[model samples]
Target chain A: MIRVVAGFFIVMVMISAATVYSLKETTQQLKAHKQQLSADILKDRAAIKVLRAEMAYLSQPARLEKLSRRFLALSPARADQMAKSVTSIAGRENFKQVAFPVDEFPLLLPQEKPVFRKKTVIRQPRVRKAGFYDRISLKLEKNE
Target chain B: MRSADLHIEGAKSGALEVARTRLIVPVSLFVFGFSLLLVRLVSIGLFEDISDRVTRRASAKTEIIRERVDILDRNGVVMATNLPAPSLAVRPSLITDPQEVADRIVRLLPDLNRTRVLNKLTSSRHFLYIKRNLTPTQVWKINALGYPGLVLEQAEKRVYPQGRLASHVLGYVDMDNKPQAGVEKFFDDHLSNPERSNDPLYLSIDVRLQYIMREELERAMDKFSARAAAGIIMNVNSGEILAMTSLPDFDGNGAIDPLAPEMKNRNILEPYEMGSGFKTFTVAMALDSGSVKLTDEFDATKPLKVGRRTIHDDHAKKRFLNVPEIYTFSSNIGASLVIRQVGIEVQKDYLERFGLFDKPVIELTGLSRPILPTHWGEIQSMTVSYGHGIAVTPLNMVTAIASVINGGRLIPATLIRKNKGENITSSNDYPQVISPATSRKMRQLMRLAVEKGTGSFARVEGYRVGGKTGTAEKVVNGVYDRTRKITSFVGAFPMDRPQYIVFALFDEPHGTADTFNMATGGWVAAPVVGQVIRRIGPLLGVKPVMDVKTEYQNLILAGNEKK
Candidate 1:
């Protein structure tokens, strides 16, 4: 029994020692990972700064204005060209209503349509009211 | 029996001696184990957190490679930022051979002098800097050489990408990472501190509006042959300066001169008489104080004599002009007469209340104070009523005008962008500068001026442009130079409810053939306002109705009844 208790204590010490070693290794790995992520973030931040400066330089209004005039044949919109809404131009009964505003907005919204859904695109010939469909229809009619 | 007892006592003594010897080994072992634990505790106490040590080392490197915050426009356009610029330095003691190292480095960096690099590498000093602000490719080439003595110390360089576009506002920094002027100098504490440098400084300036304003002002200056021109477009209610430009601006990316004409941020720094634009404040103060009524007429038939000087009316009507007529014609005689009835003390008091008597507090450096008269008198009041004898900065004038036309609340002008999802009007801490009724009346009078009076040149189609015109003689050596004029026009659009205010002023503008040899505000400045409003009104999302006349008929009809 004395020898058995001594062996149990020795096993306990070895287990505790292993747990400590594992914990230290995990902490070191975590620390190294955090450092790597931090370094990547710093590098990305520097690259973004350079890119931002480039973007501002490219999108400057003076240059864009010149480019638009040369390439797009667009000019600053006139006040009279603007309206409050689509309904201002036409009534609800008119078929030729103002659908969308025709301005040079770079970002156009997606269309929202409420039309009836077409069930099938494939065209099929009439089945002459025969066979299983004809019998099912007759039974349903009698029941009704 | 005695012999047997002696033998048992001897055995007991021997067993006791054996137990004492065993006790010493266990006690000494415990002491050794505890001592080992104590050393471990001391080492851990010394090291503390490993992350902290790494951070400290990183910071030591970053001190040389400083990180300065970027200044961005409201739309995240980077106006100013830092680029990683590697600077080359050397340890002379570590260099085994100086000449070979210098030759190899000089080959890679042709800009560096071979002699200087050799001398630095061979110097007795432990450390010496060789070259600075190297491109990434040059640094990579030098790194490939694998020289132990030569080290490329990394640092950051501040760069203004917009060049001369927003130079006066962005400011510049020195090689030592010191801020010299503009927003850089003003917000240095926030930039240099490590704990709070992550976020970019967002300004209220919109790049598009700024570009347009600058283009228009430059065009006007070129056309009129003016010495200089300045313009501002501001959101009245929020006190956000959408665009502000001063002509002859310098490139921020180039070499700077603090004393150059291009460096002067005239809108906020310089004070001028502002000519007839001052009349708006006089009329507004009179209406707000209940000293003058909109229907009351002032006899502008003759110049009003005060003490030794006479207040002359530009484009004299020589008739009894109503309040609106005085504003429409920009009558100095009429303005002075109204101030006479309004009293001189009240006029000074009103100007003080409008924040015109002191230096305007804003987020920029070198803001000069307004030039106030040493003594206040009847003549001073009369001249000041017509925009003389008292000089104030254009920014102060715009601030006061914004309050008068923007529901009568005074909000500070700020370059910093307001917080997202935050409403400036929700803050009840702002003081009411004028009554809403007074602001409404001022808007109506300004519209009447633009529609039918001397400001007729300021009419933009499909938008109700309300404004007043001022053409002041440039003061040279404490005397008015008759040949030189500073023509200025201040206007608000959609006068029924004003959203923005535009101010354009040209200094020392010469009369061109197009203007028929007239350098007055009516001829020079009014057309610029009209053109700017017409171009930007639609872009600003202000719907242009064909029936602007009918919609603002109430404001205009009220004035017509008095006429």
Candidate 2:
């Protein structure tokens, strides 16, 4: 009877020790998890700030107006133009090619020409006949 | 011998009874004390656990954690909010080599100065800041360095996605995380807490209308080379501000130097002598007093001299002018003559009733009171009749105009959304300030001004717009400067029922080639109001009326002969 009572008390002590240890481990884990969640919340808040700044920068009126004119082919409404025609053609045409100059012409390079051989032979023969008559007259004059 | 044996046995039994009796009392006392302690422990620890839980929860600071509030447009577009961000910090004492850590950090954060980072890391302080607000990828790269003592602290910052679109209305927060202007400043206390029961402030501002007004006003301001400009669009019935804008405004995240003087909010804070816009009030006072009828005519042929001051009409009638002609031609002489007939006492009462004598009560922080003439003599009343002797903020003028057109209901301007189930029309709360008949007559006179008078530029194609143009010479050192003018225009659209009141003002607008080099309110400010109405009309759910003559035929005809 004495041994049985002693064994029951010892078993109760061991069980109590284990429960306390487990509870302590769980409490530590929970604290760490809470800290991590807090860090994550902070990170998210900072990201929101960055995205807001980027949105503001991109949504600026001057930038949007430029983008609309470039991509959507939008133009300011002219006071004289009728509304129906303006709306129809405003974003339909490709403005890139429309702005190109259509009146410009390409420059041409100069070319060389060939000479005729028949004309050259006739000039040589006439020069030889005139030289012989001139030489004979010059010899008679020198002798005189 | 048998009797002696019996006597000895009895004596032994008696001794045993005595021993048992002594043990009984002490044992019973010990058992009773142990049981009492056990019962007390169980009662305190288990039975009252809920009360203990309540106590612990009350003492905890779990609710104090900073949480961001949502800022939404009238259409529920998210304008401002908070998101998480990782920042780099370090436990300096635990770092093995400060130089190595700094070099690695510089490689990851190229914007960081290597020398400065090294110095911070080498400090003996337990915690040192290496960089702030790092991107996730940058933080990941820094973490991969496997360096000890590195810490990443998390923080929240304000964000404005619409940028400068509504900068003035959605004022920016300072580095200390305090809202500084516009709605942000006006609703800071409610936005800063999560546990508070106050609902989020819902403004009457429509972002789309705001954008349209900003775009059109910017274009006009640029075209006119105006020094500064401000505009407002108010619901004439509810007195809700649909859109309000002032130029030279900074983006929410844009750097604002504290020393710069240009950061002032011109719409609510700046006071100007709002020239001829006051004519509406003066005329209203005269008509309301029964001193002058619509048919009553006054001589406006020449400048009227009162005491030492002379009030001249910009467009001289040089003949008898009736009520419609006084407003249509913007005759200063005629307005003065009408006010003189109304007398000083009546004029003062009307101006005070219009809420012009006090500082405008608005939700925003900055507000300026109108500078009224000190001495209330005939000259002061006459000049004020033409909007020269008094100066008021744009907001004050807009609200007063709204009151006149909304059938005389003086609704206090508010930024917070009205609670449901609350009766909005309870006389105990909101009382009618003006009669519907007076409102209708004022609408007719305003329409006449726009149709044939100085506010011709305010006329929209389909909308029956009515307005008054005011071009007052800015007073410098108590003397009116002829060259510097504060040109302003205030108008209400669909004059038959009068829904929206739009007011635009330009300070010291320089003459532009398109304006025929005229910087007067009729030439510069009226066009802006017209454009604002044209762009914002559809956004505010006000459909354009193609046939204006059919809508307000009776009232238009009653005031038609002068036009």
Q: Which ten contiguous residues of candidate 2 chain B have the minimum total lDDT?
A: B419-428
lDDT of 1 by residue, B1-563 (tens): 54324433565888876677667765886797689679968986895466765764474333334588888887778788888788899999999988899999999989789998899999999888898888889899989999899888878888887777787777788876789888889999887765655788888887777787888889989999998888888887678887778888988766677788888888888887789988998899888989998778888778888788877887887878778778877889989989988998888888887888878757888887899889888888888888887777878888888888887887777778776454358436667877888989888788878887778888988888888888899788989999999888998887877888888989888888988989988888899888888878887788775655522334335644654
Q: How do the residues A45-117 of candidate 1 rate in per-residue lDDT, one tens digit apiece?
A: 6566677677778777788878998899777888777766655655644446646554332422223322466
Model 2 TM? 0.71
Query: What are the DockQ scores of the candidates, in order?
Result: 0.26, 0.05
Off by over 4 Å in 1: A1-19, A92-144, B1-66, B90-131, B141-150, B420-428, B550-563
lDDT of 2 at A106: 23
DockQ of 2: 0.05
lDDT of candidate 2 over B1-563, digit per residue (tens): 65325433565887866666667755885697579679968986775445634544343433344755657665444567655566789998889988888888888888888888988888878897776667779878877998878998766667766767677777778865688777888888788877542244556676667787788778888887777888888876666777888987777765776445546677788888998899898888777778888778788767788888788878875777778778777888988999989999988877788888888767788788889899999888888898987899998899888878877766766554443333234434544555667777889889878887799999887677899999999888978899899999998988888888888999888888877889998899898889887766544545455555432333424544553
Q: What is the per-residue lDDT of model 2 for residues A8-46, given as tens digits with 9 covering 90 to 100? A: 875676578656765575555455545656655544543
| Regions of candidate 2 where Cα sits further than 4 Å from its true position | A1-144, B1-65, B99-119, B122-124, B128-131, B196-199, B418-428, B550-563
- Give me candidate 2's interface root-mean-square deviation: 15.3
